[model samples]
Target: MPHDDDHVPRRRARSVFVDITPLRESPAFAKLWTGTAVAQIGAQVTIVAVGLHVYALTESTLAVSFVALWALGPMILAGFVGGALADTYDRRRVALVTAIVAWVSISVMATIAFLDVSVTWPYYALAAVNAAAATILGATRGAILPRLLSPQLLPAAAALSGITMGLAITVGPAVAGVLVASVGFPWTYLLDAVLFTGAFLGILSLPTLTPDGPRRALGLDSVLESLRFLRHAPNVRATFVWDLIAMILGSPRVVFPAAGALVLGGGPITVGILTAAFAVGALLSGLFSGPLGAVRLQGRAVTLAVAAFGACTALFGVVLLGTGLIVGPGAPGEPVVPAIVLACIALAGTGAADNVSAVFRTTILQTAAPDDVRGRMQGLFYVVVAGGPRIGDLVAGGLATLIALWAPPLIGGILILGIMLVLVRTARGFMRYDAHAPTP
Candidate 1:
């Protein structure tokens, strides 16, 4: 209930996702959105695949997180390249190229999963490659939107993206877990390969979108220029930092896999259910999110949504605490829980809350940032939005390895709550982000 959105007048805004808003009414935008939805769903499949594979191999949560740990470097590289490409070349082409790369990476992963490859290092390598390519596609996709949709409908478009996120996270992961459990990791991953085609078609079919920035010929200099622009661009800088702090401290995804095996007892099924639960919350939020489409103060929206997210994490930690109390703390190899079914419900609540925060943060970046710098801005955005959660993964993995599995969330939940409060109080511009007069 605690939220920064309380300040936005509770005006009843019309719901638009049931039918295409004027923004996506354009055939190009519809195609682009369809492609993004396909890509998101594939990404979800791979995400669950990686988690299950790691656990299946090592039976260690820490080992699973190494997938995220390895991703840090490639993610950094891909972000820069992808963001720069978004500014320089045709954005659709950039997306296409990355999509191809990601597709190949996932294909390799599928092959390995089918083989039951005992070699863990190769799995990590392939995963990092997949993540890096995904980074490029993700950043450019965001940058491409302004060209696809008119400004008037940007907010609605963003909410629609939230619905996509909801579907990808909720539907994809749930289906993935079932598929992996019923068939195997290879089959789950193969389905992802088939879906990847949708993203390729989506990006390729879109109307040609020319570069808006002064044609700075592509190279190292162009990439460096983006870094420099980021430094000078105060709002852009603030936005990324805000995202970093919010995600690094707040994201609890790292713990979900471990929670499934250790506390919940259902293993991969629990992991998938927990992930889907988060998406459910997000998709449901879109129902009341019509007003968010008309929101003028996005900075406040980010703050409130993030705070709510932190509270949910804390609540998730409480769920862990409850399990520990009921099961009596790792009395053996795995802690026992009375009713894991209810725990999945708690995790789903956490998922929904987090998605609400994502809608606002994404809107801030898409609407506030200029086209010239939007790609790099999105690249940096990925570093945090995509990157911070990985750091949390490492933190969770390492801490879980050293201590009890429950240790990370109890600690992380508190850290998220504290840091978000401090940052919101300090950063007034973000706190005062009026959508009518965007600063970035």
Candidate 2:
């Protein structure tokens, strides 16, 4: 009895770390994960480079934020259309084609940068194209995961995906910062173009994945079906709404460039560190995600995680406010070491909380939605995931123009907490949601 008891506790302890069984059990998943992990780093670099480049040119926070705004419309349309196509066609094919298109777009971006094109419009147009293609690829790839792994291992898969994202952001932005400061913008963009080839390999290695149900034509009817399903599925809808609340109110990324230049004063390097801080938190959380897989009350987990995210974001805002008060406004050449450290700590906390929310949210969506409509659902998921932050960028940039730089996050964080509290309390179904008996 003593030996058995000790074994049980030991097993429980081990379970608290990330489960690697999914990687070992699914070779295809392993390839996809590895390839994506590498590719995303490049993607992150480009993301930071673009913001820095735009800000360098226009010297406006709103201009940097508009990068996301430019891509938002195309992203939404592509997400819906891609989801329908994923249902209608082989998911592997859809992912592969889109990956190619995205890769090409990145190359075009690099070419423009390489040729020393002074025009900014080409950058925006190409970025929109890249965002649209990526949205489609993301939707298709998300839907394909279930086909690769068993239902029981979905949580592990989600956890692993979190780790991938964590690694990407943690390394990508930091690298972009150093590269942009050292080699200039074209080289930074070119690196992304080179790294993007990994995605092609990942998609090519995957086996064909088709929808389990009868083939649905790609059009308005299919899109309407997904929307109709979402309308009735309060739990799933709540997840979407809750994420939007958290992202729109809590995201402070738009202000990072300004914060680095004017508030914290380390220039691109400081901006990179600030961006990487959040990813570091996420990476740590994912590394120890063993306990998360065992969580049955995912709805509650999501709520708690998002609440933490809001609180941390608010703290970050406070740090920024404090720094602004100490330094006053206008670009400072010297760095505020203490304030930067505090802000990074807060951002890291926010990242950890956001990753936790994401793991649960993704698991809920994949498990709750039926296989037949999974593609469409994943498409919607892409929209919320991609569009929410863009919307936040707009809000943050616009608010900063009127108020202090730190106001958006401070005000937004409070709104997130309040809104989420009301949303969770009223949605009794979500609070009581059980993973084993997922309802969508």
Candidate 3:
């Protein structure tokens, strides 16, 4: 009996580290992961480039923030329509088609930048189009994952996604800052357009993944059905609510430009470093994510992670506040080393915590939801994921204009912490949620 118990403990110990079995076992998953990891680097470059470009053109933080605002409506619509389509059609085809559209949009942006159009509206319009197509691609690709891998591997897959995201944000922004400063914005956009092809290749290699259950026609009725299902699914609904609260309150990307220019000061390079710092934390966390998969109480984990995220975000705000007090406001061309270091540490903490929350949240959604409605749920999930940041952009941008640059995050962080506590306490079911027996 003692020897048998020792075997169980050994197996449990081994389960603490990230399981790469999914990648090794599924060729399709490997291709998808590799392609996405590469493509996302380009995507991050474009994201940072666009913000820097807009800020350079307009010199307005509000204008830079509007990039996300313009993309919001189209993204929400795409999430709904594309998710429904993913459920009704072959997800692989859907992803491929949307990837082409995104590629074209990025190509157009490159052309405009190269031509030195000097107008900001075109950039905003093209960005919206790109965002819409990306949202669809996101929805379709998310729905395709469960089909490609086993349920038990979903947590590991989510951890891998953290690595993908972490690497993309970490490397892409740092590179984009250099490219924007050296070669300029047009080249940055062009690089993304070329990199976008990796996603296409990945999708192309995927086996046709159609919905598993009774097929529902893609239309208003199908969308309505998905919404109805979401209405009753308390645990899943809690995930969305908690995530939205955290993002809307704690999202600080909109202010990175302002932080670099007016606060932290190394110009575009500072923005890149600040952005990359967060991903560094996430990347490190993912790399060491051996213990996360073995945890059974996913809900409790999410709550704890998000709480940590809120605290870190609040600390970030404080760092900015200290910078302003010590270094003084107004754009100083040179960087403040101490403030930058402190801010980076705080942002890294936020990244680590957020990644942990994301792993569990994604695992819950993929495991609990049935295949028939999974696409639609994933679509809604995409909307929450995408829209929350935009809303934060608006909140941060609008507030910063009225108050100090650091004010929005300071207030928002406290709000996130308070709201999340209330939400978790009220929703008892969510607190007790178990991965082995998921409740959608």
Candidate 4:
């Protein structure tokens, strides 16, 4: 009896960690996850390196910013088209081709840097191409995920993806900073090309995954069909709307730099710490997400998680306001340690909350949406993921300039809390969404 009782607690302890059933039971998904994780980290490294390289070449912040701007339009367009293609053809083949395109773009980017090319247009063009390809790859991979894992295991799979993204964002940029300082731009780009090849192996290992539904011809009409389907997918649409609420109103990343400079008083180092704190929170949340798998009311879970995000964002603003009042506007580089600590804690809370929301939001989409339109739905998801923060940045920056450093987040957070409560009340279908019978 004693031994059996001891084993109970042991099992409970083990269950607190992320569930590895998807990895153990699905070899194809395991390979795909591993490959995608490695490739994403490498892609992040190149993204950071490109920004730093452009800054080095032109010594202009605007020039560095334009690299992202150049990619945005192409990424959105390619994502929709890629989704159509994935729904029409074998997803594995589509992913492989897009990976090849991305790899080639990276290779050319490396070659240009190796030859000591002074012009910047090549880098810009290559960055745009790589972004488009990557957007397509992401949409295809998302579509492939449902086909690989059983619906019951999908929440766990989503948690694993969160870990992948956390590592990619945190480790990748840190590695880029090290590589760029030790080697040069050429070697950094070359390393990305090498890391990118991992994606091809994952793609090759998969069996053909053609859509198991009515196939549409790949064209504008196919993309239009996806949009039309969205009109009916209230649950899916609610998921996207909830995501936008968290990202647009609760995202405080844009304020980090200015906060560090004027409010926090730690300068660039403080900015870096604030940035990494969010990723650390996300990583930790994924690590202990095993309990989330048993959750049946995933839609309500998402709503609750995002509500926490809004609260945390508001709390972060309060921290900034408190720190600013204590430090005043004159002391830029001499931030009190406690103020910084408090601010990091709030940002970390926001990250943790947002990550939980994401796992359920993604699971809801994967389990509810039909296979034929899953790719396009995922494409819209990628667009939301990519575009929301940019919009938030603009909103935050504009509000800060017009009001105060702490105004945007404080106001935005209040808006999110109010709006989300309204959404939960009115979105009856979404609020009652059950994982077992996912309907959208």
Candidate 5:
């Protein structure tokens, strides 16, 4: 492990802005980043638009949860299988194929909307297909990244990834709201299909990246090997546990549709703003992430950041609770300016804190794992990243349906705070973990 003092000199020279060293040193990384950014923006648009569309059709939060529920199984399967494939084959080809699959899925979704399909099953099925493809693409891309940059630059690269995500959610949802409101679902889905072509440019430009060690057949054993590796790898495993807690307990995105419709109002626009506010906060954090690169005790930083995330989520719940008591539910399509502002502020806080946690967690995983198992490791990471939120969606939706709309986030956030406190006490080794050593 590098001592805290080792970073002081570098810290002094670092700017307040996010370091662009990864981009400057590697042209391939830059192109890949830019292309992925463009494609991810479109993906976010579809995500937001889908939630709004589902809510409009059913007028039920539980129904919106079903969208995620439908996709969960496929996502999990794809993540494991994709990870195995990434290890056994050319990563560039795997990514390209997955991208094509995702593109076709989105195109089909657009066509269904254009045909004025009233049933929700078609949308749900298409979403599952898209989700599966996206999981593979994400896993392959993560494996490809380490090959493109030096070990020291991984933190900056993760920060850049955060910026990509930030821009995607920020711009995409905001655009989706306007486009959906004006041009309707067909056009919104169509636009996503159009923007998805950007992913191809990135994958196509990449050189072939085969796994470094002995290649094995793609099967259950291949997936199990990655799982077995995690059993002995406490540091890497710790990151996954922390992220699952943060995402499953603290993530509040599922309730946005309900909040917009029943509580905060302004319909899709309010939903967009609420979602975008989180991304805006993430964007600002990435912009100012230079100082974070100097931190040696990365594990401690991740814990602290997730704690902040829980607090902010709780704050958001409080805002919703207060708004319900005072302002009450307004007419559909009406904007509640004060409530929206407060909620955005709270959501943005969660976003900022979550972004910080993500940067370190990603850096740790990328640095600790060997190239041979990195794909499978990233695949499991994808499962947590994709599955945790789906479970959160189910929890938020089910609780909001059974109790008050504000109850799920309020309860979940409190649970996260309690669990994290307990975790930090018991997991002493994880707390003292250092970035320089990169142990797993």
Candidate 6:
């Protein structure tokens, strides 16, 4: 057996952030990261604002469900279009354009908030536009990363991303709650606009990245090329499918506001706390992830981490069950959540597990795929990572109304654990994926 020291390559590989102060050496990545970190917080704020506003206006969970269902189709369409664009153009430019479009859309949303609440159509339209734009930005920005760093550092970069996401989700919702409480929706939207400006600075600073092979502009041909590429790559398919399954069954984000309002008894504070706790868990896990670079068993790592996430999600469901049993469903007028601490802890565990899975998944994509096709592949990856949650939002929204808030996660978690086992067992080839030896 190869001992730990013997297993690790001794050639002193450079990290993804590079050596020049992790900022000066890779200003492009730093800029992009900074923009994303700030924007993610803003996103959380808007998410809270929209959910609260909708619930406050209509006082029905089904109305809030419409927000997610409304955005789903446009997002799916954008995924294919975005993937093609990522492969065809300079990814940084693509990201910049999308960010600008999204920024403008959010600005429009802020302006509309000044009008009547009955004007709901504009909110839905603007939200869909922002979702589509965000999808595009996510795909292209992911494709740009490999150009900015060497292969060995991909794991470290993934860890850094997880840590950032954890912090963003953690801080953003907490701040969003406070802001919504004090400043109201317009300022929240305005701040999101300002933070979005940083995204342009990052993308504009990047080096040009022309396609390696014959460059086709975004259209049917680009989509066909991406489809053809996917046909031969089982690992890529597995990665995307695994991600979708995890998010579909395990993500509980959509139920949070309702959980706070109905089950937990604390209202918005509980909602923000629960979401932020998830990020806090992710952030904490990343700090001890120093040896992540040495873990060549990425396939197993992703599998186990996802499993842990499912387990925690199930625990969150149990918290819901306890809330129902110990406290019963709240009266019609009550909007406060109960047993919030337990809920937060469960969410934190889920976030940490999901972050571990994400680090492995990102490294696998960056290391395995060729640079030429990587843009499109990462685009699909973004679709899976992003689109799945939207699907989860739909699932959570509908199911919470059908059965109860607890039913969606309790059932979803069980389904995730079962499906993951079958998928991993059937695709054992993925278990031995090697970063140094890329395969289809």
Candidate that scores best on lDDT: 4
lDDT of 6 by residue, 1-440 (tens): 86888645542343322222334457778887777777877776776677767776779878877787788788878888887888887776788789889999988888777654555667778888998898888877777877887776677777877776777677776676687789887787777777777667777788887657777866888878888988888777767777888898887888887777777777766776887788898988776666677778787778878878888898899898877777675632453344677787888888888888888888888767777788778777766766789778778878888988898888898888877777567768787777666576
Q: Return model 4's CA RMSD, one decimal.
A: 1.2
- The weakest ten consecutive residues by lDDT in model 5 span 326-335
Ranking by TM-score: 4, 2, 3, 5, 6, 1
5 against 6, candidate with superior TM-score: 5
CA shift of 354, model 5, Å? 0.7
Per-residue lDDT for 88 in model 1? 86
Candidate 2 overall Cα lDDT vs. reference? Answer: 0.87
Q: After superposition, how far is residue 376 of candidate 3 from its true place, in Å?
A: 1.0
Q: Look at candidate 2 and tell me the lDDT of residue 184.
A: 98
TM-score, structure 5 vs. true:
0.88
Clashing pairs in 6: 264-337, 264-338, 265-336, 265-337, 265-338, 266-336, 266-337
lDDT of 3 by residue, 243-305 (tens): 988888888887888899888889778876887788898998887787887889888888888
Q: Which candidate, 1 or 4, has the higher TM-score?
A: 4
Q: Write one digit per residue (lDDT tens) for candidate 1, span 260-360.
A: 77666667666656766767777877655666667677776776666666676667777777776666644324434444556556556556556666766
Q: Model 3, residue 215: displacement in angstroms?
A: 2.1
Give me candidate 1's TM-score against the actual structure. 0.83
* Winning model by TM-score: 4
The pairs that clash in candidate 2 are none
All candidates' lDDT scores?
Answer: 0.74, 0.87, 0.87, 0.89, 0.88, 0.77
- The C-alpha local distance difference test score for the whole of candidate 1 amounts to 0.74
